[model samples]
Target: MIACGLLLLCFSRKQYVGKVLVALGFILLVISSYEGISGRILRSLESQYSPINLSQVMAPGGSATIQDSVKWIVVLTSGIAGDATLPYQLQVSHHSRVRLIEGIRLHRMLPGSKIILTGGTGFDGSPEATTMSRVAEELGVSRADMVLEVESRDTKDHPLY
Candidate 1:
């Protein structure tokens, strides 16, 4: 949209139409990029799935009150900034950070649960799983309890790994 707007603005005979297209394109971009709006849009799509009853599956003192078979919490990461100069938390995207935190929370609730972090070397050549593992360590998760799958480049490749 932005590209089309720029092209119209540069070569189109009608300058006013080009200006309107450019303005509309910027507006659409802002609407889509805003967190509150985008988050609500995502939530609407996710509303079909019912939330889990954590109370039924989890118990106090890092033990399950019920016979909960679920153990591994696989964290399928989107992408990381992968900047070596930055801290581990800073290198992860917001979605990855949230997923990691939730995975750690669930791990704490389940005594023997493990977190499987997945992602390959992203744009900056740093492994996303390694970055998440470091952050998880700082957050008090044991390295022994974490599994890193750093060969999957994207979500589609995760099942294969």
Candidate 2:
């Protein structure tokens, strides 16, 4: 839509605004199409060579055993920010994300280990603890099994708070 509008304007002697709009539209189009292209290529390649299950690649023998003697896991959780209702939309940082999912994967190897999920809805939206609970369920832990602290907001009270 914007591309066509820009084309019309470009042909009508409005070179500056037309070129700017064309560039903006082109950037948006390229960004949108890039996801489709990469997704399609990845789907094709996955169909060709990748295994149907991810566990086959990550773990070989399904030897669910932790390397060291770890009994408890602590996960600092946060909410994801959408495009609207935020400046940059702060979310749980990538380091914290990895500490969660991958940490869950590792914790699964430890028998009788408990997962402690901390953090609440710092923003005025959904609570982070609720989302983290869902993630724990997805990672094979039950809601009854997770220790969730829903009121936590600041990191200063991470261990005790």
Candidate maximizing TM-score: 1
What pairs collide in candidate 1?
none
Alpha carbon deviation, residue 119, candidate 2 (Å): 0.5
lDDT of each: 0.86, 0.64
RMSD in Å for all candidates: 3.4, 10.4
lDDT of 1: 0.86
Q: lDDT, candidate 2, residue 123?
A: 63
Alpha-carbon deviation at 36 in model 2, angstroms: 32
Off by over 4 Å in 1: 1-37, 59-62
**Tens digit per residue, CA lDDT, model 2, 1-161:** 47765776867777777777778888777876887877987788878775224353234666534424455677887455542343321344555566678657756655566788887665656666666666567667876667877776767767776
User: Which digits, one per residue and each the tens of the lDDT, describe model 1 over residues 10-66?
Assistant: 988767777888899999988899999999999998998976678878666545876
How well does model 2 score by local distance difference test?
A: 0.64
